[model samples]
Target chain A: MFYLLGLGILCIAFLFIIGLYNLDFKYLFMISAPAEKITAAVIIIGILNCIISILFFFGVGYLREAVKAFMEKKIFQLKTVLYFKRSGIYLSSCATLGFISRSLAIIYLRVDNNGSGFGLGYSSLLIFMLICGLCFILISHVLKESVALKEENDLTI
Target chain B: MSIYINLDKVLEDRDMKSHELAEKIGITRANLSILKTGKAKAVRFSTLEAICEVLDCQPGDILEYKAD
Candidate 1:
């Protein structure tokens, strides 16, 4: 629940930054500056960011449900496994979308002769997201094994 | 699937209730029910020993083999 609240705060802050402060992609999309380029690539990146945020939100919600089931001693149930699997997929989607968005941004910057400020930080962050996603998938497999073992134990008399 | 539990028959023959036998054997009613319903994957020898001791029956009398 705390994690959900934190994500909610983050999303609100992100929206405020984009709407009022006119952040990077938002400025590219909304500003009427003479030199501002409204390329299709930036629009795609914006869409990907929106998708990543929404996916994270839903994934967190599903995880909360899984935690609730765990507290109820339903750890080895099918629904728990499914919720983790879905969250894993959502995390992977976020990483993939971030990768595509960053790649497009790099290409756009290079084309516009503004490549001097491009850094490796965003790439490293995307890689971290990818690794986290793969770990979630691995955890789901472990949970599957646990479910099988639990069923066997339950049936043993 | 070939091995069959004769717990119900043995319990009936001894005029024993499921929960009563379960308590006498120091096992949970749910576990006893599982064994009686043949839903158990495998019965431990310790539990089998307890059941046989409490019900005054042999292991063979409680468990039987049936070719499927």
Candidate 2:
């Protein structure tokens, strides 16, 4: 069910944060830097990752509840619709913030701008999340229209 | 822009109460009230048929269009 899926996504995001903490992006930077600068970059990246993780939690939680409502045949409820919309925004923010954080870390280390992770060859998880978030938003729009139509149907004598 | 119900006028002419017509048509007085007040978004064909049969009136006699 979607509730389990949301939990899975949250776990994956947590693992992603841990992976980021242990990752050696400096090797990719391939440039010598002061210890303080390296430490600062790592700390900033960690903070951004934590923020992203928090947003992910909120997003996933809302998604879980929305899916629960949907399963209960309440998909057109305005609250559920708004929950989905908020979930989409939060999920998308996670991806965008991740891109910015990692890119900034790379830029800070390499003193260059070759750190963007949006290339086709890059890992697809962020892009996938972004697409998924957009899909949720689209679903919210469809549900909103369905709500109006359903009201009309119910009122029909 | 919306539908207008003329059921009150027909009921008046037929000297039949709304409750009686609703009972004869097998619908609730609340729903009949919705129809009478023109608050209904639509009138289903089945209910229209029942109402027409009960009131001995055509669908047009019970519903009107009031362009806004």
Candidate 3:
């Protein structure tokens, strides 16, 4: 399941990059200056999104390994715990970076367009990323506590 | 740090093997090994009772406590 999700993210990221490259550069910018500046910003945000997706792939890979370890009945193993923690950190960082990049994109769009009614979807996306990052961090802490309890139980013959 | 297991001595006195005792007590050999090696943090009352019955002894013969 995780592998499939990672693959899907990769496909979407690739399609997004392709779509960006195919867009009319000057039309998207429309900033009355050298289109280079707007193009640069677009590329930066695109690259940032691509990087976030890559981080998600790593997180998913780690989650896959953690699940496999769980099935093997090694619930409290250090490796499983480390995998979960690393994945959590990766996912949280992905969401945070995504939020930051989108915030910058929204600011750039508003400033370039003279603040004329641009959609506020970016704000919702930022909130979503924040929530997702917090959930991953919370799950990681819960897994750590469970590991500690399991270790104690195992030792108590 | 205070408790001691004299399982080895009792098993030797009874002329019994570890596997034989484990079989009679209905526990895995690995678990019995853990108990014998003093690695177990705590033993269940049922397990202790089974071990005592098999060895023809009391719990005192298997476990002892000494202040560190």
Q: Evaluated with TM-score, which candidate comes out highest? A: 1
Residue-level lDDT of model 3, residues A13-106, one tens digit each, is: 4643343333224334444556655566666776786787688678767867876887788776778778777777776787678666656666
Clashing pairs in 2: none
**Alpha-carbon lDDT of model 3:** 0.69
lDDT of 2 by residue, A40-110 (tens): 67667767877887887798889888978978888778999999999999989988986787687667755
Docking class of 3: medium
TM-score of chain A of 3: 0.59
Best by DockQ: 1
- Candidate 3 lands at a TM-score of 0.66
Candidate 3 per-residue lDDT over residues B27-50, each given as its tens digit: 888888888888887889998888
Indicate the worst ten consecutive residues by lDDT in candidate 2 chain B: B1-10
lDDT order of candidates, top first: 2, 1, 3
Better of 1 and 2 by TM-score: 1
> A-chain TM-score in candidate 2?
0.71
TM-scores of chain A across candidates = 0.69, 0.71, 0.59
The per-candidate count of clashes, in order, stands at: 0, 0, 0
Model 1 TM-score? 0.74
Task: Name the lDDT value of residue A22 in candidate 3.
Answer: 32
lDDT of 1 by residue, A1-157 (tens): 7578668756744543343222244334443545457566666766776786787667657766776777788888889888878877886787788677667766864423222233324455456557756777787889999998988888887
Report the CA-based lDDT of candidate 2 relative to the real structure.
0.76
